[model samples]
Target: MVIIEAKGLTKDYGNLRAVDHVDFQIKKGECFGFLGPNGAGKTTIMRMFYSLVVPTGGYIKIFGMDLNRHASYIKSRLGILPQDNNLDLELTTLKNLIVYARYFGISSSKSKRKAEELLEYVGLTEKAHVNIRNLSGGMQRALLLARALINDPEILILDEPTTGLDPHSRLNVWNKLNELKEKNTTLILTTHYMEEAERLCDRVAIMDRGKIVAIDTPENLMGIYGGNLEDVYLKLTGKKLKEENNVENNKS
Candidate 1:
């Protein structure tokens, strides 16, 4: 089933058009990725999905309902993992999850039980009592994942979910994401990591200069354009997909 549908989706900031008439559909239980170099409108598209930004043109339908008309209802079913680790540093690992649950109107008793389950799901049960400031970067990212799941959202949106993690830590998060996929969660993620896209996404939309240049499976894109996802990116965007080194300088 198509869980998300976008037609002529566009976003503008003053004179600059960040997302220009992009179109795509994401199916239920599918891992859909947005892969591109910085300033390619990848992040802008993500923000629109979660309603952080309003579109200047066209429409988005989530679960067959128009986004503009049903934003609150649509947002309630989404779990967003933003690029930054915006965790409540003042709270303990478990408390962080519990407090976020309050935003969804979950009861204290139910939130506590859900928090414990998510902590264990992300392998942070050992650090449940630890302060957020003391946890490693990877652990904090994992905690962010747990926090995002507090509402048991059907669509989980991640923006650069593992941008700065070490290799082992990246894999740990990947393993958790893989398990989530196994259970049929619809995932929408934006990443510069070709390997991450190849490993997680069932299909990817490759964007360039505010438009999607290609949309297909990694294997199909590679077969048509290059030997790997990086090559395909270079061929389509005329830029190499590095570690998003200038991410801050090139925010779309």
Candidate 2:
């Protein structure tokens, strides 16, 4: 039931090693989370899994198929909701979903029907005809989620899926994600938000400085550190006061 298996995965940018010797496995129908602070190489590792960026070294297997050997076949059954919204602004909310569906070879009629159902699911049915430019930030995020699900992908990769939304919108997204998990979709997500990871992930890998520092269930991780996840994170990756002082002095 392993949907994703990565071993010795590494990625480099010139002399900088962004992701180094990481290994993990995600089970089918499980919610897996990558939790890290800024510049922790979380996104770099995610890009490798999605095959957007080829790995400098190691192997990535998605659904028992090698990513390099079956990139097209793997991508066909995968969905990605990146940190940035890539919706075409000129199109209406519904049109945006329809266009993405076509990329998966979904027919126009079927795409339209799927789009309508998705819009309703995301509570944006009334804004179906509204241009993307006019939708609120939360609405756009919801639309992006719905669009990612249009093709009924077996695995969904989400990068900071609810980064800038209000509490209600965040909760709505959490609910939808839980619904998807209940339907047996494998989910892989990256987030700096400790609470979100705790609520959504069955297992989490904590990365820092191009390495995985810890991996376990949120509760177990917290128990090991004798504190909440946030405290544990700070303890493991403490900031250097001297470095902060030097940066402040340089700015002045």
Candidate 3:
């Protein structure tokens, strides 16, 4: 039931070594998270998972198939939400989903139905015909989630899925994620929000400067570190003051 296996995964950008050799495994239907400050390589690893960035060394296997060998097939089963909003601004909310589904070769008729269902799933049914630019930030975030689910992917990969939304919007996305987990979907994500990781992830890997420094469940980390998930993150990554400076300087 190992859905994802990374053995000494590494990535490099020109002279910069973004992701150092790291190993991890994610089980089927489990939620696995990567937590780190800016430029800690969390986003780099996320890109590697979806085959956006080829590794400089090591390998990754999704569904027991090597990512390098079966990237096309593997990507078909993955739902990706990058850190930025990449939705087509010129398109309506419904068209955004339909257009994305077309990339997966989903039939137009079927994509339309799927789009409607996903909008309802994310509580955006009323905004279906609205242009992307007209929706509130929360609504756009929900549309992005809906679009990611259009292909009904078995594995959902997210990077800062709920970064800028208000508390209510964040909670709404969290509920939808939990619902997906209940239906046995594997979730892989990277986030700076420790509470989001603690709430949604079964286990999290804390990365620092391109390496996993600690990997464990939120409760276990908290138990050992003696504070909330945020405290555990700061403790494992570095001193709070120094870590803050590092995060600011490393923003990518």
Cα lDDT, model 2, residue 133 = 96
Top of the candidates by lDDT: 1
Q: Relative to the true structure, how large is the alpha-carbon lDDT of every model? A: 0.91, 0.89, 0.88
Q: What tens-digit string does per-residue lDDT give for candidate 1 at 191-245?
A: 8889999999999999888999899999999999968999998888778778454
TM-score of 2: 0.93
Scored against the true structure, residue 171 in model 2 reaches a CA lDDT of 98
Report clashes for each candidate as comma-separated counts. 0, 0, 0
Can you give the TM-score per candidate against the true fold? 0.95, 0.93, 0.95
Pick the winner on TM-score between candidates 1 and 2. 1
Q: Per-residue lDDT of 1-252 in model 3, one digit per residue for the tens?
A: 999999888888888889899999999999999987777898888898878888899998999998888888999999988888999999999999999999999999999999999999998898889899999999988888888888889999999899879999999999999999999999998887778898999999988888998889988999999888778877776645246645675674
lDDT for model 2 comes to 0.89
lDDT, residue 106, model 1: 91
The window of 10 residues in a row where model 1 has the poorest summed lDDT is 243-252
